[model samples]
Target: MNIDVPRILIAATQSGAGKTTIVSGLLAALRARGLKVCGYKVGPDYIDPGYHRLAGGEPVYNLDTWLTDEQTLLNLFARTSQGADVAVVEGVMGLYDGGAGGVSSSAQIARLLGLPVALVLDAKSMGESAAAVALGFRDYDRRTDLRGVILNRLGSDSHRELVSSALERIGIPVLGALHRDEMLAVRERQMGLLPAEENGDRETVSRMRAAVERGLDLEVLLEAARSAPRLSVPSLPAPARRAARLRVGVARDPAFSFYYPESLSALEERGAELVFFSPLRDSAVPEVDRLVFGGGFPEVFAGELAANLGMKASIRAAAASGVLILAECGGFMYLTKTLRTLEGSVFEMVGLIEAHSAMNARLQTVGYVEAEALKDTVLCPAGTVLQGHEFRFSTVEPEAPERFPWAFQITRKRTGATSLGGCAAPGLLASYLHLNLLGNPACADWFLGIASDASDV
Candidate 1:
């Protein structure tokens, strides 16, 4: 099957080159022109997609080759991009930065999907030397289609002219030039840009769209997107029709908002109705067959979550009644007996797992991990392997580490170091590892299968 979806990748020379701002602005600008736009982010990032959703007014999707295979990633891109005039993908870190051998890099994604690349070059310091940096990125990998460049953080008209002329001389088109504006800066915290849900304002996006409209060449970007070749991929079989026999409550407040749309969709496709409830604001958990706690900043809102004693008791009671529960990262921390904030303030959590989590001054781990299930669990059986990623600052300590039911043998991809992590029991699996169920559909099947059986009881 061949599909023609016009798309462009907005990548950067390195991190902090204003790719998020530019992409967000571009999405809003395109929508302002009455064009339906789809937004995507490369690699595993939950925060940027929040801004993308705000700007695009649609659910943003992720494209990661590490978490899923290339075919699966392409299928997701094609499926989500339907009915949109154009798709704008925000790249992660640098164009070539990824796991070992550039597995999930923006450059790899661009090449794999045949998407045109628009490099966002940080031009804060140098003038003509900016062209040299852009040239290096363009020439570094011939396979990557470097269509044009957007100059960010420019000083003056003269600066733009100098860099534009240099890039033009090198046969690279200058698609845009944004002057340095302090007002356009997005607020940041420990995990990078603060989630847009917490921003709670459209003024930032409005300012970004105005700047992009004043500086960028929208027509040229459209032309580059239209230049993308048709993507030929295998057609996916229609999903089997099945009635939703189980209800799954999902934690989805500002404090627990990290979830993959595809993962949730996978559950829905497998005959599970997802019910979203807030642990911070809701008084009680909804009656459901299973519960899911995704990753988020639970430590930041520990006081609020702890204050919701009713919700905590409801979750604890549900867990004790043999309700299947799955929690990852922030969700995992929320399931512990206690959570200590970075400032030494401690608060009680759901207390389903006999463990305590404490926020550290620095990141504890951040990388791709291959998880091999050590024992039978609700999601998977023993010896099942899944690909996922872990990024967190908090550390979990089991009250009785030696007696804890460790779920998986996690192996870091870069170092190959193995460690026993997570807590698993008959109807619970709580861990720091984040998995995209689209890549591991069997796990989703197993999860829903168990939920259906438990519902029957």
Candidate 2:
């Protein structure tokens, strides 16, 4: 299908160029103007999209080339932003940085979608060199449609003017110039920006809206966005039919809130009703045909989780009672016998698995992985290839072969590293790798089928 959707890609010269800050404010300001603005993230990030959804009051979809094919990305963009006034995509790290060969970079997204790019240059403590940075990015790829520039963290009027003059000489439009202000920044931790569910994010968002209103010219941005040409989106086959009625329970709370919107949506598409429970606060797990526990900062709240012995016991009972379960990363750790924090504090968790995990200062495994299910588990059959990504700073301690039987034979997509990881048993599937059921929406059927039929597992 062909559609003319006004869109602009917000990119950075590098990672810390304040593109997320600008994107958040623009989403709020545009929505304030009564325009139905839609936000999209270009990579495998979940936190930034949370803030974008809070700011724009809409679901922010992710566009990644590696996880999904080009046709899927186009179809997602067309469907999600169908009734919106404009679409804003927040780029990842550097505009050109990605896997081995710039596979899922923001530049690739823009180039494939035929959208214009807005280069955000961090101009603090620099002058014409900012122009050199912009020029390098602009000239690095002649096909990149770098339409405008946004100078961030300008110290003074002279600093703004200096950067502005340098860009004008190079015939690039300056959309906005923002002075360095602490109010424009958001609190962050090791996992990048904190989720919008945290306290005080509303006030921070309000201040960001005010900052953009005062420092930026929204008319210019809207005009550039409207200038994006019509795009020819390729149509693909719709997702297959799913199972009959079924109920699925999900563990959700501050400690276990790292689920992909697509994962849950994929389940819903398969006729599964999701029910959420807090493992840290709830006393009992909800009754459902299947259960899913995604990743989060479980170590930070080890005390609360360990103290909730009632919920832990309930989960243990479910694991033994033949309830289908799919636990990944933090959820995988929570199902272990214990989780030892970096501060040398050990917390007791659900004893569904025989292993214990220890938090490490350095990340143990992170990247896209292809796993072959060693045996028929709750999620897939034996020798079935599964696509997923893993990011963790914790690993199973002692790493004994017999104590922790390997479930999947995993291969890292980025480094070609191979390892025997995760565990699969009767009615159980636990791993550190995060699976994207949304990219291949059909995969949800296999996991959901486990809950439907007793003989499948």
The CA lDDT of each predicted structure is 0.91, 0.83
Residue 237's lDDT within candidate 2 is 69
Q: Give the CA lDDT, 0 to 100, for residue 110 in model 2.
A: 92
Model 2 scores what on Cα lDDT?
0.83
Residues 359-446, candidate 2, lDDT per residue (tens digit)?
A: 9888687667788888877776688787777777898753456766578999988888888888876778888877777775645777
User: Could you report the Cα RMSD, in angstroms, for every candidate shown?
Assistant: 1.7, 1.9
After superposing candidate 2, which stretches have Cα over 4 Å from the reference? 450-455
Tell me model 1's lDDT, rounded to 2 decimals. Answer: 0.91
TM-score, structure 1 vs. true:
0.97
TM-score result, candidate 2: 0.95
TM-score per model over all chains: 0.97, 0.95
Off by over 4 Å in 1: 238-244, 450-457
